[model samples]
Target: MGVDNNSISVSLEKLERFIAAALRRAGLPEADAATVAGLMAQADLQGSDGHGIIRLPQYIRRIRSGGINVRPDIRVVADMPGMAIVDGDNGMGHLVVSRATELAIDKARTQGAAWVGTRRSNHAGPASLYSAMPLRHDMVGIYFAVGNANHLPPWGGTDMLLSTNPISVGVPAGDEPPVVLDMATTVAAYGKVKAKAKRGEMMPEGWMIDREGRPLLDPTRSDEGFLMPIGGHKGYGLALIVGLLAGTLNGAAMGRDVVDFNKDHVTPTNTGQAMLVLNLAAFGPVGGFKEAVDRLVGDLRGSARMPGTDRIWIPGEQSHARRQRYRETGIPVSRGVAAELDQLARELEIPPLA
Candidate 1:
């Protein structure tokens, strides 16, 4: 049972099982493996292919090399009425952040809002995973993270000192799908560049720039250039602020302390992440608020399009459609990614994903 060389369409169940098995083989406990696998699979279902199971090989490598703790004693180190800090003990990021998000949601249910931070965690999947966690409870979720590696520099300076530093917010609606916004401060995320390189594709001109500030379109030459920020100094400022809140405030890796997890698998990245949960009932009636959101979303989507545009879409509209399509059909995996996963399966003596 192998897939074609061009691409592979994997069922959600198969993908989740394969990932869980791989994680178990990599020494993660069964429950922990299942938790991580489910979250990563949800990421893929939501169209975040770059942050889904594609990261398994790197995570497994880090685990095997002792970069991540397999048996982590994750615990809350500081506690307050509406805020708390957790130490992940260098555990898998998905596990750490999932726990943190749950804590935030529980606290917010009672206190109206709660903020939770995690330190000594690994690279979790997409930011949307954590941000969307509160949607089931009719709460708004905000998530931020210090990226696992530095790929950009200060607005004008040449030194690479800033990561993409992503953020996500998920707001529930009455009858519409939740509005989820997930974005990096940069023009493009470094993972997209890596995905392009894996597919042997050229990047868009604006994605990166060389030291001389020349457009660099070749993804293979990413090392020779730095990722460009979205709005020059503005994006740089956003990244800096996110890093401070998610990294410095949590006593986790940031700036010069961030280790390139893709390159170095042995060092503990101590990645920092934060989640804030806001209870809708805290401000007013949850039902009224959600209905208002639904109306707002409808208004946005009903707007007329420009000359070449087809239709207008809110933040999570396309992703919700993609998730539906993937659920009905299957998640498409590029040949390169499938091959890498196959190799990883073989190395771990687990069933291959096809």
Candidate 2:
């Protein structure tokens, strides 16, 4: 099965509208729902389709099942000049993180940098949005998170022990797209596996393997396997470190406690995560750093492409292009996603999207 390439890029505004409407019907206040919906839509614009509108149905399910709080009174449980810990009050991750990012940016403006962590934050879509906040003020932003669901086992264990645990870094560059690199520590994100499984497509080599060490590309049998780390043991190490910092350090769920939001929607995720914002002026002039970043991107693109390659693409180039195009055309929800969203709207008694 193949999708029409011409229909792939979705209009960003429409996507936000759909999500916002859905959340309101699910009982979230209009303003809070719109804020989260807008962020989710922007995730798709940035090429994080798995983290974007694809999560709408799950979010709805969580809210209806009393898992996620619709009117959470998010607040800071701990605070300092350069650091703080947030209590999401079982609210949506989008609201919790937006608050944390704002707090970080405000404090960074005064301290030249700041770090913020959040506990009890639910799934917040992609990490890039939060990481890109400081760019408006000429600051570099970095974010990491404990995946709401765990899909990987320890190097030698069969028990699902860890999350894909993504990391996103955004660095502003003069006259060039900010160098934003958002990637899962796993060779392939768990979403890719789900997509493949849904489409009845086999995954490419190295995406996963059975516990016995044989390649497992048949996504249909994914439950019997685990995701492969990016570079074998090295990637596994990084995932472990991220789990510690983003999960354990934040005093949130870890190890066997991570509830699979997809499988069960009634449990409080208690997801933990942390981010650091670095003011460019803290190191030097913002202009100089941006120029250096531009040069850095230029240098990478100037490198020779491999045989059969079209052009050298930077880490965030594809996402940047997607953002521009999707901002023009509404994001494509695919026939399957649309059907799911429609079903959710019915359950909530909300008017469905066209």
Candidate 3:
């Protein structure tokens, strides 16, 4: 697909290298910079525009402000046969969650299932990034995270006590793309609001509302309102449950204890996340499980659709297609985002992304 006129298309290789270079200049070790950069680029590759290179400037700011530890001693604080708790030491979220997910996958290989949780991590982009990791090993991956900033209120209240806590699940398939579902418990993630503000675009009416309960369509005025939960009170409930699992249960920050990462770049957020991996072989034959998943996926896609609907889509299919298309046509970065990245590169005295 062709990129819009207001955007620039760049190869994934260039994007990853630029991110890594900028991060390295900011203080992260070469290996850590490369690891975080690769995941950030993969977010863009999967069309997660809000969580990709758009976050580089913020991360750099935090790093420079000493809010993030460049050389964190990420280690498992508590360990059991089927579970573990990792302390990130205020490190970058990508690196923290990657270590936890790796531990989860390793344990699941022998234990049939494993749950790994992290504390003192930072924003880790989209949840699907980690959840999808287990798919390569023919294991189902489930991930949860407490958003770095609290943009959500409890049901029927104006207090920003909750966040756009997210959940992601990845199920491996035989012939079909993995069934990956990644979503915020809110109607929209705050990252999307940030993305819209950067692009100078208005948000849809339902994403948020002002303190007076009026619709908030202007992304630039996002702070004046709070994000709305999906499915009304039900989404609020889910967000709370997710926060308890990913945050409170792990002894990480939650509720009022959560730091506003966007405004308070100097304070550690103590962000929390959890990764659960289930070995398919333990449930049954891995191949059989995958085949059944493929069959169900085909059935869903071929099912009848509503009058105006052209086709039915399985979860993650669109992102899968985006990944394939991006490989061929390059990833699209809005000019606004590109300009900011260029400015950051100038400040870092590194090569520009273009």
Candidate with maximal lDDT: 3
Write down the RMSD of all candidates, one decimal each.
Answer: 1.3, 2.3, 1.1
TM-score of each: 0.98, 0.94, 0.99
Write down the lDDT that model 2 would get: 0.83
| C-alpha positional error of residue 289 in candidate 3 after TM-score superposition, expressed in Å | 0.7
| Candidate 2 lDDT by residue in tens digits, 2-114 | 24632343466667777898899889999998999889988877767678887888888889899999999899988999999988999999999999888988889889889
- Select the stronger candidate by TM-score from 1 and 2: 1
Please give, for residues 240-335, the per-residue lDDT of candidate 3 as tens digits: 999999999999999999999889989999999999999998998889988999899999999989999999988899999999999989999999
For model 3, state the Cα shift of residue 44 in Å.
0.4
Q: After superposition, how far is residue 136 of candidate 3 from its true place, in Å?
A: 0.5
- Candidate 1 C-alpha lDDT tens digits along 197-311: 8778899889999999999999989999899998889999999999999999999999999999989999999999999999999999999998999998898888877999988
Please identify model 1 stretches exceeding 4 Å from their true place.
Answer: 1-5
Query: lDDT for every model?
Result: 0.92, 0.83, 0.95
Backbone clash tally (model 1): 0
Which 10-residue span in candidate 3 carries the lowest summed lDDT? 1-10
lDDT of 2 at 73: 86
